[model samples]
Target: MTAKYPNKEHVTYATFLSSNRREKVDGVEIGTQFTKVVVNHPLQENEELVRPMKHCKTIGDVHSEGTSIAWPSICIQKING
Candidate 1:
């Protein structure tokens, strides 16, 4: 299967579910149907890199209304490299 975020730096197991659909397997809900099957390539060590964003802080006076800041966006990278 193709990676979810192909342009991304890392490859993860969850990436396989990108273009998949929901289905029921043996009365249990599972992944998508077999649209196509592709051979899984051998994963290399340190083949992929994921640079995740860490903590972020805003410098301002807490009691000052105008000096405060809003919430920031967070990106968490799950590495399977």
Candidate 2:
């Protein structure tokens, strides 16, 4: 591997969703994964997204590990308690 990438530090990797393999017992999968350091913005045609953005909200909106940010795009009603 060193021969192919002697200076790997110079490599600027973009969002890639190739860490996990596509495996489905019945072809139904959903939810988000905060474990990935790099998340593919525009999912490819042949790629499978195990996690969906909608499910993330129900799970505390954890887009990534060690970080938590409010989803401003959602229409949240401000009800005074």
Q: For residue 30, what is the lDDT in candidate 1?
A: 32
Please give, for residues 1-81, the per-residue lDDT of candidate 1 as tens digits.
122223433221222222233433223333333221111232322232221112212111211222111211121133477
Model 2 over residues 15-51: C-alpha lDDT tens digits? 3222232322123221232222232122222222233
TM-score (C-alpha, index-matched) for candidate 1: 0.17
| lDDT assessment of candidate 1 | 0.23
How close is every model to the real structure, measured as TM-score?
0.17, 0.18
Q: What 10-residue stretch in candidate 2 is worst by lDDT?
A: 1-10
Best-matching candidate per lDDT? 2
lDDT of the candidates, in the order given: 0.23, 0.24
Per-residue lDDT of 73 in model 1: 10
Return the lDDT, model 2, position 27: 35
The most accurate candidate by TM-score is 2
